[model samples]
Target: MTEVRCPLCKTVPEHGRKWDYGERTTVQCAVCGFYTITGTAVSIAERQNISHKLSAYTRDNTERGVDVPEINSNNLSQLQTSLPDYGVGDKQLLYMRALERRSKFPGSLVQVTPGIDYPLAWASGEEEFLYLLRDLLSRRLVAVPEGGTKALREDVSFETLITPAGWEYLEKHRAVSAISDQVFVAMSFSPNLQAAWEDAIRPAIVESGYKPYRIDDEPHVDRIDSKIIAEIRNSGFLVADVTEQRPGVYFEAGFALGLGLKVFWCVRSDDLEHVHFDTRQYNHIVWETEADLKEKLFYFVTSVAGKRTAT
Candidate 1:
């Protein structure tokens, strides 16, 4: 009828297109690419179109669902009969990405290393991310309750319904294809941090022979932390580039320690100035140039097998 709202900028537009999901009317903005999904006018929800949001979330919780035989004591004996062959959820997507780019060396799954740096994947928290794809294939609505890089990951598989609507959404978006599985030098960065991070550590981390990973799963799609946690925990050594005094980095460091892996810490001097005495006093590497970070990170990371077991 009248103009709907824009998806990128949620303002009622002079002209837009209305896309309906049969039962509901979803509008897309012709001028600004904003649209409406579900019943929400969508302007109240800036950077979100109504129709797009509707596709992602249910009218209730807005999470994606999985199609598989869920495990239950009532039917435990039929495990094999229930399990499917390929349930490539987010983690498997990450693994697939890791596999795609990794060198064709034996022991690659464990040793090929990663390529992108997706903070969301890390932010998925431990339990939620551990062996996540496998869980997502079998369950639905894996959740990160705390809402940050350090929230608790809990699977909501038990309380979901597998719907064809979600599969349609996934097919249209190819959310599976967008995850970044490359290893990155993590820093609490904004636009300013990007330059500094790339300049100081990005190349070096790459030089140190790590492929970074990024997670770009659609919001309602499954976000499993299983394989991620398993990879990080089982990693022979972890290097936390603590350039920023971030709680999430500390959480990952603690996770590394809990796993009893060798942790190579790094920080910029200015940033290092702000770190707590407990962290500052620790034997962390201080690097001003990529060469130094690369030299040291490579020396340590490459020597992990000789220095530490792949436990």
Candidate 2:
């Protein structure tokens, strides 16, 4: 191991290390965490000036306790394209969540170094990170000890703690029924797709230990649109199949995403070309047949959402 500047953030972290293996370089960076980058990916990132976004992407994944990622040529384009564009409010909320995760207990001080940990909230750089931190402090969502701000201003490590209000804010914004046994299905109700629903989508959710609910399958006195919203809120996650290019399905999926609920995208092989340009960047499960959809959906539910616990 040798000291070197992080290929993603271009920062020479005091504790960072690098290892070379032929065409790839594995780096352990204070800002971006552990990731390996191929030579081609390095060039692309630099050329596109997306190194900051890539750093944040890697850091966010690392903070979630996932395996170290390899930013290679094959997936770099998709990875960069799929990166979420968070709004200012969302960025503030994300920063608070990061602080919450780092805190071992209530009121536990978290050591934050703007120069080293700016990617924790997807901030473009230290200046943006400090701006967000100051906003949190002004709102009384976080507290810094005396002189801590001075250290922070100097681009050094400063200890700050999440306030009680911050915890409440997170709780209010948390996704509903994250562990519910219900999985919502948003897809076209065409008779031709009945087999796909019955043999594929429904069976996949059931086999994964979750109850599948399609809004049209059950009768309700409420308006259909209102009912759909209610059911989606109660669901643990949603499976959106855009095989028919239905506008309603897209709306429902977008609504779920706005609520921070996971929405797995899927499309029939024949209809893949019709998927909207806006959502095309998502990694959709393209299926040629009902059986293939079932197998793939089942695996995705178990691996990404986790197999539901038995009652």
Candidate 3:
């Protein structure tokens, strides 16, 4: 196997391999947040610089008797046309960009004031911003007080230190730059809840011009974790219902949060009290019937996610 390295940090990411998309050969390094675009349109100097660096690194390591794998030179021209589109979620993107902008000083940690004037809050509405913040905190991407990890409702100042996983995931998912068109729906597939998802949740997502996806819809495989991660990796946002209080649904929602994906939580009135204590701090839509879900979900998408209203 060829070993590709991040040009900026020289780290080899697991997903660092370049894939072809039409006229471009792109590489996203989750380790260093480096997204590379190369092809006929690339400048000769840039190409030469990368090639020279790789060659020099390889030669130096080889002379030192280090077992270094070389990047496959032959694969440069081979294009993988069937590669899936992997993009960063909008809310995740906003939070990351804000972090980058806010942490511009000469330090690994920074204190950010959360409010309308904040960078993250500026790009996103209040509700969405709070949800994204909770997601980041839950994922441990940013450090916060042990008890302060609950969903932020007020404008409070908090200290944040970026974690290694956060940096790599942000880079790998292209979270700071890419905009995705995928929405993941996480809910129990019980017979009674089928109508709610099809009529309310999925349709609301469709109206936002993003494709809605569910785990059960994916082909079942042995490793369910891998499939769930892959689908989240390819999605821009998530919607989860904790009505059933299923462990799998909670896991899915947590995974998405760790990845900094926007998640909308909802539950049936009777089931609301059954929701996990940790997640109870966040605001959840309490709906009685499918029609109520549809109306509320539409409003949620339009107001928080900024769905396009038809002119």
Candidate 4:
């Protein structure tokens, strides 16, 4: 195997490997992990100078052990737009979540190499990752060995443990619906939109390995508002289709967001102009046909929530 510069970060990873198969190249880099990139995407990334962001995106996903991301010209722009804009606090929380995921049990020691694991926090580099670790240490949310901090500062690998306080913090901040396999659908219930629900929304959720729960789908004796609230609380995430500019959809989507549950927004292409002004800024999957909505929604669900494990 010959040394090859990582197409995304332009750095030669010490443990990286590259394999060329006709038009696409598969690269496994210390920074970007494993990803396959098409010839067109490599050129586009260079021309747009978005390699750093792309590297972080790929690295983050790779760390999560999800489907290996393929960067092709068709989806490169969309992927760039979907890259998270994590703030300092968000990054800290993300880092903590990463640590929690790696641990087999509470207080288990998790080894980390900042240089390679920085992207787990969506951090720009090792410096920012160390800054986050320092903050966690200061807050006593995580504990290192007596001299582990100094070793980490020197860019040495070390195992850090999440303290009891860290467990408590995560428990408090964790989403109530994190364990659920149900995805709530908040959309217009008009007769005109029935086909959209049956043909696109429901099928997409099922194909993504999650149950779709819409208010009208199940019989309930409770008041509509009460049942809606209860079901939303039990949902893992939400799909809010604002095709008819429904006020209830907006309220439900907002409620889910307040609970820290992910909400995917959607709107019919023709109804795009009528979406509420406040939510206009959010990226919405605008679809011209049911087929388009089904495809996009399935992709979004699998990308964000990941496919549920089969029993």
All candidates: TM-score: 0.35, 0.59, 0.49, 0.57
Per-residue C-alpha lDDT of model 3 across residues 39-141, encoded as one tens digit per residue: 4423442454443223222332333344432233322222111113222245565466557655755236666555432223322234545666677777877
Give one digit per residue, the lDDT tens place, for model 2 in 94-200: 78888888899998999988888788778889999898889989999999988777786736888999889989888865743343578889999999899999999
lDDT of 4 by residue, 1-311 (tens): 88877787677877655556567777778878888888789999889877766777777657756455578897687566545466787678878888998999987899998877787777877898899889998999999978777687636799999999998888765743344678999999999889899999999999999999998886655458756765775687999999988899999999889767889999999999998999988899999999999999999899877877666
Order of models, best lDDT first = 2, 4, 3, 1
Model 1 TM: 0.35
Q: What is the lDDT of candidate 3?
A: 0.60
* Residue 93 lDDT, candidate 1, scale 0-100: 44
> Candidates 1 and 2: which is better by lDDT?
2
Model 2 scores a C-alpha lDDT of: 0.83
Error of 4 at 134 (Å): 1.0
Best-matching candidate per TM-score: 2
Q: What overall lDDT goes with each candidate model?
A: 0.40, 0.83, 0.60, 0.82
**Candidate that beats the other on TM-score, 1 or 3, i.e. the better one:** 3
Between candidates 2 and 3, the TM-score winner: 2
> Worst ten-residue run, lDDT, model 1?
111-120
Clashing residue pairs found in predicted model 4: none
Using TM-score as the measure, name the better of candidate 1 and candidate 4. 4
